[model samples]
Target chain A: MKTSRFALAVCLLFPALAFAHIGQGDIGGGLVAGFKHPILGLDHVIAMVAVGLWGAQLGRPAIWVLPVTFPLVMAFGGILGGLGLPLPGVEIAIALSAVALGLMVAFAARPPLWLAGILVAFFAIFHGHAHGAELPDTANAISYAVGFVVATGLLHALGILIGVAQRWRGGAYALRGGGAVIALGGLFFLASHFSILPGLDA
Target chain B: MNHFNAGFVHPLTAFEHVLAFAAVGLLIGQHGLQKAQFLILIFPLAVALGAAGARALPGLPLVAATNLVSLILFGALTALAKPLPHAALLAFCCAFGLTHGYANGSATTAQTSMLAFAAGLFAATFLVVAYGAAAAQYLLQRKISWIDIAVRVAGSWIAAIGLMALAIGMRGGLGR
Candidate 1:
């Protein structure tokens, strides 16, 4: 009877064992996760969209240059993060991006193309490094990059749509109001990361 | 079946190839059908020649460096959104299409049926380009500048991926 019981247990356990690692090392799974990384993060969303908003406010060449500069610089940052290079205050910098870009949009600040490009690129490093540091060992590097880049671009697009509201007088005021809200959110994120607020840290 | 599958799967499997094909389409769409006439026609022909050349000369260097470079350059141009002259765009497309076709050709084997492989490759490329061009043309027709700008931003992402691929290649070559 005991032998039969043992045999039955083995049969039952074998099925579970076969699927123990299912979805654990899949490249496609990793790609999906990477795609969701930016979407899942509030900090990333605010800053990425703010970039597009600011670009639209600035208009013309700034519109293209800001977005163009970001991913290129961010890739460098990701490579650095992948190499295990330590970058201090990445979280703080990410939070700061939201604040700065929000204010830029709110004020309708029109910096030169070079300055706008530099500012966006500066903030992108922290965001990219954060995402890159979390890469799965078993993930296809190229696919993961493609996934996250697509996600980031989509976020920027969303911001551009919102920023287009600035083309109208009432819409411009609404965008400014939205920018203020985004800036406030960034400040809250900054405070929370620093553990300055008691209940807010959670 | 194997030849057809191999050809069909090759470009889809490579992010660089997929992005490059889409970028070409986006460019053509942005410039409009009239201005991109030469480019639209010459690209596939160059691709066919490149694939044939690769098969004919098996010992040719297939370093993939050119592919990375093309990805970086064209992606940047797409983001810039400036219209390139037809002659320039045509030359660019021919050069890139040839190089990429060569890479795609390397995937085939002696047992592969030439007709099947060519058909599969042609179908995939045609579809990718056609889809991108149609989508872009639709947005432009609707005057949806937001979506258009989004496409341009996507080009930046492609360039970034190219940079990453380049870095990876360098790291692999340097054994670190």
Candidate 2:
């Protein structure tokens, strides 16, 4: 009983290390790595969340429309990157996406639906290119793609859930405040890209 | 593992197969159970037939491409939330089942018992389709506005994954 208790305690305490073997191979590793890619990047997170915030602010069809539009456009962009096609200033554009979308959320800017979608779609290209270009040669490609897309969708859902705050009093201001922080973060990323912020990589 | 277990676990193990199966279920389920009952039966039967046929047939080309296309087709259909004629729906489900099952069959060894493997495959396929249908039916019956939007979003995600996989495949990055 004591030995079993000790083993159970060790398992609980070191679960990640214990389960480390699960993701060591091609499929599982690819899934885990792909899921982590967008999430680990602060720039990606903020921009994706800002999309949801802006969508929620726009109300009605735009709320669902923007989230739906993003993944499809992003996949097209991924195809380009996978094909080794070059898109200019990808990193800069990615940072700019965060800045632009963040500001849209911060200012509660509600543009025409088509314009908003076009803007989101434009940014999605940059984000997708970065992910696709970095696709590991060793991992299972299909699993990796599924992992990343699902992760990206969940991030958008998170932003949408946060945007749900719009229903209450002062919630709108809170969302704007969140948007401003995201915008500032984007500027920081941009500055890092430009070498203005030394020692910090975006 | 026994052939039966191998066949049963095969579809669950493959991400492409799971996604395609789920998409079919969701699309059919979105139309309601009464309309979906026929399709639900047709899909698994087609899978069994495809798996059995794989042994006698010369290797089919573009199995991977066809599987990815099925994902895109079924997912896009679900996302659109548009109704199809019964015949069209049946044809789509049948095609999806056959191609995916053939892919699964090609993976199995010749020594495996065809009867046991096909039975396992059919059972697993039926369960997946049923589960997907149930989830979609539950959501639709609830009549909540967000539930409808959520299903569409899920559909789009599946389609996006399919498109991305196709892109990767074009680059020769995807392994069989």
Best candidate (score: TM-score):
2
- The CA lDDT at B148 in model 1 is 71
For each candidate in the order shown, give its overall lDDT on alpha carbons. Answer: 0.74, 0.84
Clashes of 2: 0
lDDT of 2: 0.84
DockQ of 1: 0.21
Assess every candidate by TM-score: 0.78, 0.91
State which docking tier applies to candidate 2.
acceptable
Rate residue B127 of model 2 by lDDT: 92
For residues A1-202, what per-residue lDDT tens digits would candidate 1 score against the true structure?
Answer: 9999999667443422332222221236456867898888898999999988887787776777777778888888877776668899999999999999888878877777788887888888889888777776656556667778778877887887788898899998888878888898889899999889887751
Residue-wise lDDT of candidate 2 within A22-82, one digit each (tens)? 3221366478878988898888999999998898888889988988889889988998987
* Model 2 misplacement above 4 A: A1-26, B173-176
lDDT of 2 by residue, B9-54 (tens): 6676677888888988898789999977888879988988888878
**Residue-wise C-alpha lDDT for candidate 1, range B40-156, written one tens digit per residue:** 556766665666667787756643668777878888887778887777887888898888777777656777776677666766777777777777767777876556776787778
Clashing pairs in 1: none
Superposed by TM-score, candidate 2 places the C-alpha of residue B144 at a distance from the truth, in angstroms, of: 1.5
